[model samples]
Target: MITYNPKDWFTFIFRFHKADTLRQLAPLIIGISVYCWIVAFLELNVFRLSENSHVKNITAMHTLLSFVISMLLVFRTNTAYDRWWEGRKLWGSLVNNSRNLAIKLNAILGHEEAAHRSFFKKIIPMYASVLSHHLHAETTRLALDEHEHPELKNLDTNRHMPNQVASMMFQRVNRLYEEGKIKGDQLIVLNSELQSFTDIMGACERIKNTPIPFSYSVFLKKFIFFYVMTLPFSFVISLGYIAIPVVAFIFYVLASLELIAEEIEDPFGGDENDLPMIKMASNIKKHVAEILN
Candidate 1:
């Protein structure tokens, strides 16, 4: 994610980055401006649509549609941010649950079960790393010390990596139980943390797989496109050459909102507006290791 100090108001307002919507919207803004200029010149010099009563009706239509678009954009952005926040919360749960599992393992098994305790602690961060990569559909070949986790090198890449890692965790819990390393009462507590692992994984999967409905998104795009394209005709009739910048600014506002909503809708991606999954997962690893160490 792009990080910068908001030194002054001007810098913050004009700050440009790869994730900024202006890069994508610039071409469209220019097209809209040129179209507005043409319409203004034609209506004033040749066709004289500016004085027509129809222009007033069109402007009135735009005024109403602008309100509707504003409301729709609000809902879109809110929904996107909700998904983003949900992903962050799920990661937070992963961190907390992992820490809880580690603490309990250390308390229950302690130095006597050092080898087994180390297994779960090491794999905990592996799950987080693979889960982050899984959401982004990237390959995860995270290096692991073979002595710590023998199965780490053998885990099947064909299967869901997070689920596989969780399965290994559950298997270790069962082995400990079979050997009478932990009592049933302690087993119940550890199993609960194990379940939490699955729960967090499921929650992140839901947010990653599900997206804004196609119909709603498409309709909004089409509506906004028509609205922005026709906007300059009426605007130019009223404001002449000045309407170019005015309509361009309007296009920028409307398009920027849609672009931002799109960017944030998928919070798992590596975009600036997306959740910092890499850093978050690393932090989880570091903290869990510190606890176990």
Candidate 2:
């Protein structure tokens, strides 16, 4: 959601304010640093256990752990990015379908038909907004004013506002068909759009409901934790006081990867890297109105 000129890469990097990773991972990083420091201090100064530390051989595990952890992190990031990309694609499809539906409706009924134009202009975008809010698990969010969309009162009460809004679209199309405003091939086209609306919503719902498996996530976290935790043991003996920062950096990399994966795995939510649902819906509303204009 952080928008800026791509040409100004330096300013973009320096000034981007969405500190999502730092906000979440800073505490864990600090805790890991503190833990590493404590272990180093005790081993180097107080106990001197690191001087004769037999566990220096544990550094050998780092080769295999490093490879496994890298592969795991790669898998985790890819899985999350796949979900995020799919969400973006779905929203893109919704945008196209809404525009197509709007254009087809306007063309068929004549743009001078104020009631018909208004219905498509308002309702299609409203469906997007409602679906966006619904996917974020937010209730009581209305994109259209009651004066414009009196159905929100009924929609508010429905368990699934997006589907209800889509149903409303269907009813409107059916009305157009019965009144002969859009029948035959035109009806088929409109019905296809309606079906696309439903199908897109269903696809978004599937992504929202399903997630990266919990056990897989837990195992990765545990794997990274135990592996990085053993870093100080191997390191304090060799690096002396420098092991704290080294372990901390290692912890930062490993922990940040997991945190990032968690954040993006559910890309429907309002994260920095999430599909900008509200903005997309709002743009849909803007474009719909512009088309009618």
Candidate 3:
């Protein structure tokens, strides 16, 4: 995500970040301006409609519909933000669980068990890295170590990567339990964190797979389009040429909100506003290595 100082209002206003909706909206803004100008001209010069004309009543309709549209946009934005925040929370849980698992394994395993230490250290973080790739629909190759462990090499990239990784961790932990490496109580303690890896993965998958309802999304776009297109009809009578900029600004505000909602709703993607999955995965790797090593 694009990080910035929230306190720096002037910088935010003056600088157009790469993901700024203004860039995407610029061409549409110009088109709307030109369209508004034509509408204003036709209404004023050609139709010669007066303020008392029935056409001017459209402004009242807009005033009432503005409340409705604002409510819809508020719901839309909030819903999208909730998904983004939930994704972040799930990843946060993954980070905490990974750390807990590594810490537990460190305490339970003998200091001489370098192989087990190496496996847990690499595999815990590998879960996060693999989940990140899984959500983005990329190959789970980046997380693979140069000297990959023999057990991890059996992972079928064609299958669900996060599940395979989780299964591997569980199998290894179970083996440790069977071998009397970890006691019954220690197994129970480790179970929660190990299971949480899959839980977190499932939650992330829900967010990545399900999207905002298609009809609702389509209706919102159409609502904005029709609402903005009709603005000149409402304002042109009294405002004349000035209505062009007024309508354009309104469209800009409404359209920008939709654009932001769209970008953030899928927090796993490459959008600048998306959750920092790669960085989080790297942090998990670093922290797990620190704990296990």
Candidate 4:
């Protein structure tokens, strides 16, 4: 994600970041400007309608519908942001759970049980990296170092990688319990963090698989398009040629909201605004190593 100081208002206002709505909407803005000029010219110069023409009544319709459109856009943007925030929270949970599991394992295992310590250390972070890749639908084998764990060897890439990694961690933990390394209560403590790995994975999958309703998204886009198209008719009588900029600016604002909603709705992707999955995964590795090693 692109990091910036929220307090620096002047920099954000003047500097156009790569994912800025202005860059994406520039072509559409120019097209709307030209369309507005044509509509204004035809109405004022050619048709020469009188001041009391019925077409001017479109302004009242626009004024009334403006509230409705604003409400819809607010809902759309809020829904998308909720998904983005939820994804961040899930990752935050994974980071904490991974550290918690490592700390418990470190305390439970004897110093001579370095093999068990190493296994939990690597597997805990590996689960996070595998989950990050799995959510993106990329090959998760790339996230693993094959030599790290024999249990992780020959992991079926065709199967769900996160589940495979989680299974390995569970099996090792169970083996520790069966071998009398971890007491019953210690196993119970570790179980919560281990189970949470699957819960986090499932929640992330829900966000990645599901999306904003198709019909609703399409309706919003259509509403914005038709609403802006009818705006020139409403403004030409009063705003005249100046309606060119006014109409274009209105389209820019409305369309930009939709564009932002689209980008943030799927927070797992490589978008600059997406949750920082890779960075969080690396932090999980670092934090797990510190606790376990």
Show model 1 residue runs off by greater than 4 Å: 2-8, 50-53
Candidate 2 ranges beyond 4 A from true positions? 4-20, 46-53, 143-153
Q: What tens digits encode model 4's per-residue C-alpha lDDT throughout 125-211?
A: 989998989888888755445676656676899999899888888899899889988789888888888899999999999999999
Q: Is candidate 1 or candidate 2 better by lDDT?
A: 1
TM-score of each: 0.95, 0.91, 0.97, 0.97
lDDT-better candidate, 2 vs 4: 4
> Order of candidates by TM-score, top first?
3, 4, 1, 2
C-alpha positional error of residue 183 in candidate 1 after TM-score superposition, expressed in Å = 0.7
Candidate 1 lDDT tens digits, 1-293: 66677667788787787877889998998888888888888877787774564775688898888899989999999999899888888888888887888888878876776787677667888888888999999988877788666667778888888888889889989899999889999989989999998898888889888899999999999988899888777877678789899989988888898888888888899888788888888988888888787
262 Cα displacement, candidate 2 (Å): 1.0
Sort the candidates on lDDT, descending order. 3, 4, 1, 2
Pairs that collide in candidate 1 are none
